[model samples]
Target: MPDGTVPQSVLEIRRDLAAAYRLIALEGMDDGIYTHISARLPDGPNGEKRFLLNPFGLRFDEVTAANLVTVDETGAVIDDPYGAGVNAAGFTIHSAVHMARHDAVCVLHTHTVAGVAVSSVKEGILPLNQWSAQFFDRIAFHDYEGIALNLEERERIVADLGNRFVMMLRNHGTLVLGRSVAEAFKLAINLERSCKAQVAALGMGLTPVVLSDDVAEHTARQYQSAYDAMELGNQSDPEWAALLRRLDAVAPDYLG
Candidate 1:
C-alpha cells in the first residue's frame, strides 16, 4: 500500500473505533469491561466481512488502535496482534447487526445505567425532549432473552431492529448501528442522553409533557436528514476529530 492508502484507511477505522471506546468510558457510559464497540473493515486481506473489535479482558480506556483485533463474520480472530479474543456475547450481538445490516459499518453497544433502566420500563424512550423525539417511533425493541449467548437470537434481534439504527435490548442495554464510527458514536451519545434525561425527569415525581406525534415525526426527519448529509461528506466529522483530540490529551495511547 502507498502512503495515504489501504493501511491508512484501516488505521483510521481502528483509531476512530478505539476513540469511541475511550469516549464511552470518559462519559461514564461504560460498564467496566462488559460492553463492546466494533467497526467493519471496508475490505480485509481475507475478505470484506471482517471487523475490528476490542479485545476481551481490556477496559475501554486500555484499548488502542494497535491492540484491536480483526475478526471474521463468525467472530473468528483473523489477525490479533495482541493475541486477544473477543467477548462471546459481544460477537453475537455485533456480528448479527454487521451481517444483517449491510449499511451498518459500525456497531456500538453499551450497558449504561440509564439505558438499561429505560429499557426495563414498559414505555421505553419517552419523547420527553427534542433529543428523545429523534428516537420516537424509530427505535427498535428486542425483548430480553437472557445474555445473548445463543446464535439463534441473532435472527430475532435483526428482525426487531429492522430498518432502524437504534435498538433497546429489554432488561439489557442499548444497541446502535451506523455507517461510520462517528455516526454510531453520536447516536449512542444522544440515545444515552435521552435515557438519562427521561430517568431524571421521572425521578423528580413530575409528569413530563410529551411532544405531539406530528412534531416528533418532523423533528426525527430533520435529524435524520442532517445525519444523512453528514455521512455523504468526504472528510471525517469535526466532532469526531474534536473528540479524538480530547482523547489525545488524556488517553493518547488509544491510537498507539
Candidate 2:
C-alpha cells in the first residue's frame, strides 16, 4: 500500500492467482516452470502500476499466494520474500499486455502441447465445434519473435494483440486475458480445451467439416453476450465458482 506492504485486496488477488496456477497444473496445461501467468496489482501508493508473477523456478503447482513476487512497471521485482525473483522473459511477455490493456487485469500464458499445436498452424482457432466457435474469429496471432527477452518486442506484441481476449503466440503457445483471475482462468481452460479438440479432430485424417461462417459468427455472438453480462456485473460465472470449489477441495495449499 503506502510502503512495501501489500493491501488485503492484493492478497485476495494473490490467493485467486495461486489457485489459477494450481488449476492449470491440475488441468495439464502447465509446462514445468516455463510459461507464466500474471495479475496486475492496483496502483501502488505512488500511483505506479505493479504486477504479481510467479517466481522463476517454481512449478505451476508449487506456486502459493505468499510466494508470488510483486514487480513494478519496469519488470523489476519489488517484493520477493522468498528471494525467488520473477522470470525476465516471462515479465517481458506479461508486462506488454498488462501495460497495454488496462482492463485486462489477469493475463495467462501457457505452453501446453495442444496450445502449441494450434499456434503452429497458419489458421488459428478454427470453428470445428462449439468450444472452438467461442474463439472463432476472436483470437489474435503474434509471430514468434525469438525468446521475447528484448524489451522492444513488447510494442509489437501489443500491436498484434489489439483488443482480442485470446492470443496464440505463433509456434509458441496461447495467451488469454480476463478482467479477473476467475475470468482469466475460465477463458484459458476453454481455449486449451478447444485446442485439444482441434488437434484430435485434425488427427482423424478425414476432412473435418468446419462450421460455416454464419454459424461461427452467431455462436461467437452468443459467447460474447455472456461475457458482456459477466463483465457488466449482470451475472456471475457458475463454472468459475465450481472450479474454485474443486481447487479448494483438492489443493487448499494454494491459499498459503
Candidate 3:
C-alpha cells in the first residue's frame, strides 16, 4: 500500500507470476484475445484473502506488477490502475477453480494452436513420447460450450476439472492449476510441449512411442512434488529468469 520498496517476498512473487504470463505469450500459447492467468494473494498471519490478476484488455506480454489488478475473493477489483477491471468471464472460470480448490493458488489457461488441436482429438493426450509422458494418465477433458461466460457453468467446470492439474477444454484450449505461480507455469509449459509433440507426431503419421504404464506412473509421481517457488526471489528457476529476459528483449514496456 505504500510507495516504498515492496516487501521482498511479495515483490518477488508478483514478478515471477507476471514473468510467467509474458513467457506464455512469448511461447505462442496465447489465443488472440483469450486465455488468462491468476494468482491468489498469499494468506498472511492475519488471514488476508485477496488475489491478483491481469486486466481484461492487456496483452500478457504487456503485464507487470504495477499493472496487475488486485481483487477480492468476490471478484471485485480492489486497486486497478487501468480501470479495466477483471474479466468477468475469465473470473467465472478462475473463481470456481480458486474457491473449490483451496490449494490452487495460481491458474493458467492457454489457447495455442497445438493445445486446441489436441483438445479436438477424441483420444485426448496419449503417452506419445517423453514430452507427452508428463500427462500420461493425468489429462482431464471438458466438453465444449460456446463460451465460458456463465456463472452457472462454474459447477460444471469444477466437475470437469476434478482432481487433475491439466485440463483440456474440448474444442477450446488447455488449463493448468497449481498451488503457486511457478508450479502452474511449469505445468502449462509441459502441457503445451506435450500437445506440440503430439501434433507433430500426428502430422508425420508416425505411431507414437507410447510409454509403459509403470514408467508413466513413475514420471507422474516425480512431477507431483509442490514447487519451491518462495525462493524465486533470486530467480531460482533458470527457465523463469531466461523467460523474463526474453520478455524484456521483446516487450520491455511490459514491466510498467
Candidate 4:
C-alpha cells in the first residue's frame, strides 16, 4: 500500500497532465488522440518510477484527471482506473525522454498541421519571429523511423534530443520538454506559433527575413532572463493561469 502523501501528489500531477491535454486540444494542436503529454509521478509501487499518460483511444478533450493511466518505465500499465491501455507509440516516444532527461518533468508532443508542415521541411523552424527566435539553435531534430512503436528507436530519439528542451521529429511532429507542466506547455505553444508563422510566411511566396545570429542569440537571452525573473518571484505564470481559467470555464471535468 502507498503512503498518504503519494496519492495527493499523484492527483495533482494527473490534474496538470489532463489540463495539458485539454489545453492542447483547445489550441488545435491535438491529432485525434494520437499525440501525448506525459508527466512524471512523484512515487509509485515499491518506489519505482512511473508517469501519467492519457488513456489510449480517448480524445484530448475527453481526458480527465481520473482517467489518466499510470505506466512504468517499460510501458506496462501499472494502474489504470478507467480500464484503458497505453498506446505503444506514446510509450515509445515518451519513455525515452523521461528516462534520459531527468530534468524534464513533463514531455508534451503534438501533431498539428503547421508543426508537421515545418517538420517536413528540411530547414525546420526558422528564426522568423520573436517566438521562433527563442528556439534559435536550441531545438533538436530526430529522423522519423516510421511509427515509434519499436523500443529500439528510443535510443536514437534520446540521442537526438540530448539536453534540448524542444525537438522537431523529422517528417513527423514536435516535442517539447520542461521541468514543469507550465514550462512544457509554454514551449509547445510557442513552438507551434513559430511553425504557423513560418508556414504563413512561406505561403506568401516571399522569403522570410531571418534574424542575424547575434540578434537571435540576444533575443533568446532576453527571454531566458524574463523566465528567470518570473521564477524568482515564485508566482504562477499569468499565461498558464489564464489558460487554466479557460479550461475551468469550458472543460472543468479535466480536473475530475
RMSD of each: 4.0, 4.3, 5.2, 4.3
Against the unseen true structure, what C-alpha lDDT does each candidate score? 0.86, 0.86, 0.76, 0.84
Q: Name the candidate that leads on lDDT.
A: 1
Winner on TM-score between 2 and 3 is 2
Model 2, 227-249: lDDT tens digits are 76676566877877788899889
Could you give the candidate ranking by TM-score, starting with the highest? 2, 1, 4, 3
For model 3 the TM-score comes to 0.86
Question: By summed lDDT, which 10 consecutive residues of candidate 2 come out lowest?
Answer: 1-10
Show the colliding residue pairs in model 2.
none
- lDDT (0-100) at residue 142 of candidate 2? 92
Per-residue lDDT for 110-200 in model 3, tens only?
A: 8888888989989888886666777777887789888888778878989988887789999999989865676688788888888888888
The segments of candidate 3 whose C-alpha lies over 4 angstroms from its true place after superposition are: 1-8, 43-48, 225-236, 245-253
Model 1, span 62-181: residue lDDT tens: 989899999888888888888768885678889988888877878999999999999999999988898999988988999999988888999999999998889999999999998788
Give the count of colliding residue pairs in each prediction: 0, 0, 0, 0
Give the clashing residue pairs of candidate 3, or none: none
